[model samples]
Target: MNTFQFPMKMVKRQVYDRIAVQDQISKTELLQEMDITSSSLNRILDELVREGWISESGQGQSTGGRRPTLYRIDPTHRYILGLEISRVYSVLGLYDLQMNTIASYRWFMDEHMTPERLVDYVEERIDWMLNDYQLTWSQIIGIGIGAVGPLDREKGIILNPVYFPANGWKNVAICQMLNERTGLMAVLENGANTALIGEHWAVRDENMQHMLFVNVGAGIRSAMMSGGQLVRGAVDREGSIGQMIIQTDGERLHDQGNYGALEAFASVQALEQQVRQRMKLGMDIWEAAEDLRPEQVHFDTLITGLNQGNIFLQELFARSAGYMGIGLANIIHILLPEKVILGGALINANPSYYEQAIAVARKKVGYDDSYQPIFSKGVLQERAVAVGAAVMILQQMEL
Candidate 1:
């Protein structure tokens, strides 16, 4: 018989070149896109089908007669791993080729995230998760990590983050390290970008193009997406909005040499500091939030109090939402994103936060839909960063 020594790289390219254009396409259309003859394209499609990466999903509607078969990528043919590393904990997520989460692990880092220890811990967890799912290492597309910034994505090392207790993030090449340990390609990205990706994935409307995703937790940032891809600068530092000063006269900052930023005014630590100051004035938030569990101290109690008609807590959240609006208004005036999604711990606890934030923004930016983007809460909520991380891995692998 016959043996066609297929150039694997070209075949891979041809397969993805078709997949990259749309969710599905016809063999004739793909042949035109590839600038190849029908017979050659048919041969490539046959090879892809035999390899189980592409599938024939029946015929398209006939314009007159003789309908053509529609082909599409098999989403289950590959998978990607995503990791969201925070100060106190981490979450590992998995995504299939269609950019859907198959499974996840919410892990508490505790005191064990030391630079030396974290690598092995993460590796073990990845292996265990794959084993549990009965998936092989070869099926993994890649790994994507989203962590607190300012991160060195090129070096794959986390620098000094505001929340964690560390001398400084050491020379930790997380991607390279993970690749060495697990034998898979890995990529690293900022946590805010992951949040943006999560918001992007949740959009049901394809026409709404531009978006600014704000990750409002212990720190604040805005990740921008334009024309369906992240808008990174020439150096890739596009969305580090935490350092944009909103206050004229604020207190001194850490030894990091930054001051009077939105992070200072609106971070979780700032809210905690306010609570401590209120405590000095004999305002017992503990008694006010008496029904709250210890595990739910991270602003759920405040949200509860607000929901239960506690005027004091309502005022606090309202004020925070107001400040958030102030920041977002600035973003709207500049970027004019079609939508803005609010994520992180504090904001997601109450749906009212979006209302309050929009209320404040309306006063500042106005309510005209003609020039304004739709405002909404992040659909992925707290899992956004983790989910984005997983998706990032998949995207990098072009799965």
Candidate 2:
């Protein structure tokens, strides 16, 4: 059966989504939760099962007279492809209906990687993954890409992404290209926004109505969810917080040429650049790692230096954390989300950095107890963007 040919009715889609999230739900429970009539609910359930989207899992405990039949999304019925594209690397994964990663792969993004080349690489990898898993293309419901932007999300195009080397990549219709190659529905979204969706679904916190997700990796970006909906601004660049100026005299980031931007002071790229600059001045920044040259310095090297008692690295991280705190404080003052989730390679590599940033953020908030927000680390780690991309596709699906 075609994966996307499932029930299209809003009620039916709701039923499938509910069962997908709850894992298993009794017919009686679904009846109570959904506003449809008993006959209508039964008809929808029948259609879902007929379409291979759901199955009668088993019987549930009896409330009084008779046991109710339990329904669950068929995990093997369909699959989703999630791709996360960054300036440094890309990640791709195949996820089951329940958002479990069946398989995943990561590859570095070279400067020569143009839009066509990137699409070709992804298509090849996707074919291999499908073959390895003994799955067919028909089973793939869709493909979702989490990419750097300013994107034209509605057009499914990548528009002049900062730091991307290939000049031809500008105005690339990524979704159309992938769709043509793979014969699957494709979507493109900002990496940070996709990460936020992934975190929200993974956490499954029903009470989380407002949230802020900060990604502090090669560059800093954020996504906000207010009142259970993503706050995509008029141009869908609402969460491009990296461009927010944090200091009047801070160094400019090379990509956007935005002076004193939050990313300039807090991103992994910023940290590495600072280390490189210090090395040029004859500082022993590479003392922790033997044979590591100044030009070879990267985020991982700095993380290693910090772990090995490098005083300079420690001070650098502390200072970066302070800047991050200030940036987060500004975000809080504007958004005032109930929870702020911090994630990225740097934050995940060292929890202390996030803690330090949160400490400073709390201090900056001052005596405003009403402005308190729960600051926490992201749960999905490296897979957040990929999984979130797939989840976004799933969310848009009718079933």
Candidate 3:
């Protein structure tokens, strides 16, 4: 763990966390809370104010001599663009300096399975979104991209993204490319981390310092937050939990290198595959799914049937939830987050589907209500990653 001195990164984060609470914070209280001398803290606050990232909000009640000034982040001093890139769609949103979403747009692509298509798809949406908002490029302080990994954050590239090779984006420099194309600064991060940041910043819980971001969709990952900062351990490969072997002897594939992993059971592709395999056995899930739209399988139908007490669907979901529980239990034992926030399509399709899994996790975690970890759905819902990306830009400004 990195130690903190006065006028350092940790001190700044401490101040921001406090300011984040009351929408504004007083200087004396912050200095006292952070255990920093007034002179040093004032110097740092002055730098922050001069940067236009923070401003005086109001006068606080006088202690004895003079009333102290309250400071808050400049809500419109700058803006951030949060771009969430997925295999199916790209969601973009603009946020004021205070991490509030001002505008957003969702763009879908038929074939973003390659680097060129991926880049083009993002560039197009970014151009249209900025134009529609009538905001000059200069107003955008920074851009943050939430994407699938294993990624090269330094290089700003997705490294061999699974199932999307044709998009011409294997090792593609997403940050540099977007920076050059849009003339804005950019940071690339894991989708799970983005979602986690969204959840963390949204809850207004500065005290809930440690938590886990469990994304359950096309894949499953675990992003851990400890002591306020994200723990991207050892080369930014912290949350790649898709391949944790949950079953010793299950159907195996030579796909992403982990045999019979949780992804093989819980991912959207896995769910679709289960439906397809059931179809071969005289159970046509396509009919049960009630999918009419072209190229769009109705996952909601599966969820509906599971909710309405379809035995076969229930069994399928139970087993999938079991795998999810296995994954969650492993994460709980290892990282021990205070809470686990679930995100992604599979979880959103039917949160009930994962209830059995949570039960199983509870069994493994034993009983402890005081510091027990509770599982909850992400507050941002579908927009979690995008919003997190925007929040990332705001945080990067060191506000």
Candidate 4:
């Protein structure tokens, strides 16, 4: 929308990003941050307003004659579609420019939610939302996908990830499929990294130059950001955190073949298996809820058992929490981040698990009034990846 010749595209985007991140910013702040002349900034601001991306919010107190105009991203002019496709479930949200959700849908993954079926579901959801809002497709910018890894981000494809409920998940070009269906560009990113982006966006003013986000679910996923950029390994192995060796000869392993791993003892699957083994030994905690199969024993039942004061569950969860702490401690010693965010189904379902893990981590690190990173539960909860993917879509925008 910006047809200017003097102000470059990159510089214009830089200005837009600053305004979009902040709740509100003044003209003076923009001039100081951009280091550009008043005339150039004025031109860029006008273009963004005309493009319906940003607008003058209000007046800022002035040092001189007239008050300076404040700027903020326009909330309703444009929209972005963000999707989080994970092994456990998937979410779709339509967000405005300010990352506010307009309409959203979520579904648990089952044996039938294949890649093609997922695309169809996304298309139907988007159409339903557009009709409800009375907005046309032209107002929608593009799509952003935060999916489980290992992903070929360069190719916008979902690479092979284990333990998915459905078959035919290997090497799916999900980004392209969405683009073809919606007629908008699509960007692919690791769900964990997208969640990190989402958390960082929420805490952009906290001065956390080094931050780590770890998601614990059926598997462990992790992403780090340092100096405002994501820390990426050569391969897209966000789930590799699950494979971190917690013990050399502990004798347990994931079905995916990681021996003596933290996930073997701490993952939801591992906890379920442990609970089943205990039940076989005549443990009497099942009256808290329906007696489910080992494969069906998920966080819902576990949380119910925990609430019923099941002693066996308390001790078992304590051990799993301890393993989680050791894994986090190892990462902390290596990364030395300013903040560590813990999220996912397990942490979200059980508050005690989170508290215990953090306590163990602090003790393992020798808590002596030293510089320890602040550990937090992700405030965005399950929506982190989807909202983060939307933020990434905004970041990839061009003038």
Backbone clashes in each candidate structure, one number apiece? 0, 0, 8, 0
Clashing pairs in 3: 113-166, 113-167, 114-166, 114-167, 114-168, 115-167, 115-168, 115-169
Q: What is candidate 2's lDDT per residue for 255-351, written digit by digit as tens?
A: 5557899889898888888888877777676556556676788777788778888888889999999999999998898998988999877788787
* Candidate 4 ranges beyond 4 A from true positions: 1-7, 23-26, 278-285, 288-293
Best model number under lDDT: 4
Error of 1 at 294 (Å): 13
TM-score against native, each model: 0.83, 0.92, 0.83, 0.92
lDDT of 4 by residue, 22-95 (tens): 87898788888777899988888999999877888899888877998888988787789999999888999999
- Please give the ranking of all candidate structures by TM-score, highest first, separated by commas: 4, 2, 1, 3
Residue by residue across 269-296, what tens digits does model 3's lDDT show?
Answer: 6776676566556554534455433234
**Model 1 lDDT tens row, 62-175:** 878789899888888888887887664678878887667788777655544675566777778777878888999889888888887767888887665665643335556777
lDDT of 1 at 186: 75
* TM-score, prediction 3: 0.83
Off by over 4 Å in 2: 1-8, 165-168, 288-294
> What does candidate 4 score in Cα RMSD to the true structure?
2.6
Q: Arrange candidates by lDDT, descending.
A: 4, 2, 3, 1
Clashing pairs in 2: none
What residue runs in model 3 are displaced by over 4 Å at the alpha carbon? 1-21, 30-51, 64-66, 112-114, 128-133, 233-239, 253-256, 286-311, 367-371
Backbone clashes counted, model 2: 0
TM-score, cand. 2? 0.92
Residue pairs whose backbone atoms clash in candidate 1: none
Alpha-carbon local distance difference test for all models:
0.71, 0.85, 0.75, 0.86
TM-score of 4: 0.92
